[model samples]
Target chain A: MSDASELPVGIADVEAAAVRIRDQAVRTPLLGSAALDARAGGRVLLKAETLQRTGSFKFRGAYNLISALDPAERDRGVVAFSSGNHAQGVAHAASLLGWASTVVMPADAPPLKIERTRAFGATVVTYDRATESREEIAAALAARTGAVTVPPYDHSMIMAGQGTVGLELAAQAAERELVPDQVLVPCGGGGLTAGIATALADRLPRAVVRPVEPAGYDDTTRSLAAGERVANAAGASSICDALLAPTPGELTFAVNAALAGPGLVVDDDQVRAAVRWAFEELKLAVEPGGAVALAAVLAGVADTADRVSVVVLSGGNTDARWLT
Target chain B: MSDASELPVGIADVEAAAVRIRDQAVRTPLLGSAALDARAGGRVLLKAETLQRTGSFKFRGAYNLISALDPAERDRGVVAFSSGNHAQGVAHAASLLGWASTVVMPADAPPLKIERTRAFGATVVTYDRATESREEIAAALAARTGAVTVPPYDHSMIMAGQGTVGLELAAQAAERELVPDQVLVPCGGGGLTAGIATALADRLPRAVVRPVEPAGYDDTTRSLAAGERVANAAGASSICDALLAPTPGELTFAVNAALAGPGLVVDDDQVRAAVRWAFEELKLAVEPGGAVALAAVLAGVADTADRVSVVVLSGGNTDARWLT
Candidate 1:
């Protein structure tokens, strides 16, 4: 089951994805914060992915997936399902590639996000997240229209594309002559964590990558510890809407389990504090899910004294309520 | 009154200052927003100065002034007085240059700014704004200690230093091949406006610079229209605490009046709206003062259709109440 054919997403694939999305996705800046350093007992290099296209790192994967399609496949369009960020990313990437896109989002998705996704020219299809399956909704739409399904995560190509963020972070850190002692990444389905972990494996051999999640939905944390899949309670909810994935993806967990450090969990109040800190000190607009890694750093989940560290602020497509 | 010696600040001064602060100051990014463009009916490039050192463009001037001082002057130390942003900038710049700093601040200045100033190793001297004068306190300190006083925006070097923001904007915009038709800048003592205006005059000759102010405190606007100086109402106040200069600085006005277009005013509500817009659309944490130029852009102060425009977000240092 774990043979070569089943594992196409090597570091080379991520490197190739980087090349494919070079001009398309934003090479976000690596930011430093003295105030954050004072709080965390270590210097911080913020991978400000909030400034990326579509206000998230999702664009990297979306662009990579859409741009790889053959003309025949492209003509049939692409379909995706996301709570918000991935929807915007896929819609934006498709529009840029001149391929049609249809995004199936939960009916209760943020209004601003829904509006923005549609503004990017993607046809919107909604389903009850509580009852109907978003994957089924998207699959049905794709089956009827002959559109290819673009999974938000879990896919080899998608993982490779998200992995490009790690590549850029490595290069940026190297250019600044900073070898991070630790890299804390916010995890949803572990795609970002897996990608970054794979990139850092060779680049910063001394560094440890950690996945951060909301407290109640620490499936990735549980999975990492148990060496098997785990799922959150079906009714569990979090203010970190973008990080509500039920379980870690199989492909993502395979890489993450190998390279990532102990998983870290932060509560909603801590997440809110992190968001406030981002605004107050870093002057950055960050959504709750994106702030988890920073929240971990600030809360001192790990010993980081006198060491170089990086926290990936992975997304910022938030509703108005998040700001308040 | 307008002799060559008195006119020490020029486009050349700004260029020289940019070189001086090359490694010391952050070269902030020029941000563009499609959503903002759609609302304003034109292309809008935001000069995100909020991300600068000390979270404002004040650092440019502070570093430039401090770094250029003679060895003896540097040893004597630097003195500055500001309600907030300039205090932090001076303190940070002085610490970087190995100069002792003494910041005379109002007793009611934001606690965060005061703490940050102290964190940078500046000695804080608080005065009652209602009775005592910050200027007198700073002058007495300078006179007693032989430390050179660093004026916020009135001095030639300070103006030259602030002008570096424009030098950067011109280059960033040119790299993107965007020639802005108009540039909106938040104005206090007019250092940033003067700096940007001079830079734009030389680099993008087609661009017209406009000074944007909060409605009740349009002193610069009144000054420019009268071809002389004007003062704000003694008791006037607004949410834009960073931009509440009683009158335009003589040196700054000289450059601005010659280069900038008519002034534009945005009210408190409009400023709040722009701040929300920056958070919601640009994914940027912008203070009330920093949001003024953006407010003018979104408020349709000018006919900006189909033309490249730049809005300078001059500062981002706010207390929690501001966000709420």
Candidate 2:
């Protein structure tokens, strides 16, 4: 196990990020449903980031990263790449801080996300997921316009920002006299899992942090198993567009590999079922990518028996028609 | 204009009920959405009772009333009459407290509610909403089974329980350093409205509490205006099945008439739009009746400009098909 001092993000950094985003980002509720508890045959607490600003936990990292930049850097603007949730988060956070933002998004991202990103006053550049690389597009844009590139997860500051979710979750759970045995976080580039794992290490050391991903995009799971970064097969696709990251981030993987428990993977059908379950049972709208952790829990992939479990519903930016 | 002592439900009662139900019921969050705030042109806080146990604030009242019963009364079982939400609440609460429950529900009530009520281990008796009187049916059932009748919102204990929503909201808002100028509640029998109004009278003296209802079922509005109970036209209908109480409850109106502000009404289309907006923007699965207050706010009928408004999303018990 890596020492806390060696991790890219630490509890102290998460604490600082919490202070920075305290006034700007929402403290989304840690919700519980008796129906869900019965289904899991144990207590289940949901960290509803779907209720977070920009309808995702991405705002925490985005705001933390942007707010820390100097005035000169802020004036130069920022660029980010995401399937949907992070784009909206960056757009909204940058707009709130009076900085222009440009996002490189998948061409087939849910229309609602694209529209909301634009509505936040960010210039959106759509790129084909199969052929074009979003990183190249964002890097080229940043290089051409002299804008700062705000990576989705890799940075220490970004991981610290996302770690606030874990900070809040641990505190909220403690308030309710709950000691969670495990926390399931949706893994994209593994930033959320790594951040949460680091926070949990400080707040609730006994609580295991597990990364959950869609089956085809289970690079984080494979990477963790191999004890090294492993890329997903090229042309792999799933309904969870947001979690289609090629591999775990180098920084995030370093932290997650040391702190996180074994990763969990769910299929598209399980994700769809979880989305429906969230709507019907939890009364929350969760997108396919956001529902992977929930899918793992509902699919009996997560061993929730005789334990208090926290499942993070990461985002809610899907089209209404998809829910129907 | 009502004094704290004069109200049937008071802050003290709500406080006591909050303590009683503290461990049993979920203390739902007071959520704020920037998107919703921008649309209202001011701050908008949502008291998400849709996240409450049994998917509505009804569980608070039901649990409070059922838990307070004597051992003999508990053994005799409990009976309740509701369009849907109250039935599920009473059923679930009674089941949790080891008491048998029977609910009189509208025959046309959402199938989801009916199914969930059964799932909660309640015996459900259905009556034609347009023809049969639910009160009479529940009374008969209670008479036959010697079960204690737990009226949805009429009783003092029930009102006290529902008032806890306001108690929590006030505290939550205070935590966020927000002093709400107005609170909008979706009114059916006025229990929730009266309870909230009474709580706010003590906690937030300057905040105006307004009852919002569907246009055709604006009995609470008319009742407050005329200083007497006003019944809706026979056979009146709207998509808001849960808010179709023929007239305001006598006990609830007595408290509301003095404590609540003038009522607000929204048409079915406005309500439908609010439900869709909740799904799209707020990411909450609010039923039509629960969306009435939100509809009033979204339709520009609530005067949200330059003031902090709290809208109560009362329930989430509609069929998924209806959301589509």
Give each candidate's interface RMSD in Å: 2.5, 1.4
Docking class of 2: medium
Give candidate 2's whole-model lDDT: 0.91
For model 1 the local lDDT of residue B171 reads 89
**Local error of candidate 2 at residue A204 (angstroms):** 1.9
TM-score, chain A, per candidate? Answer: 0.96, 0.98
Per residue, candidate 2 scores C-alpha lDDT tens digits across A74-141 of: 77899999888899999999999999999999888888889999999899999997799888998899
Score every model by TM-score: 0.89, 0.97
lDDT of 1 by residue, B72-185 (tens): 667799999998899999999999889999999988887878988898789999999889988899999999999999999988888888888888888888888878888899
Q: What lDDT tens digits, residue by residue, belong to model 1 across residues A1-324?
A: 133234546788888899999877777878876567788787788998898888899988989988999866678999999999999999999999989999999999888789989988999988899899988888888889999988888987888898888888889888888888889999999888887877777577678899999988899999999989899988987889889999999889888777886899999988988888888788898999999999888877756789988899999887545545
- The weakest ten consecutive residues by lDDT in model 2 chain A span A315-324
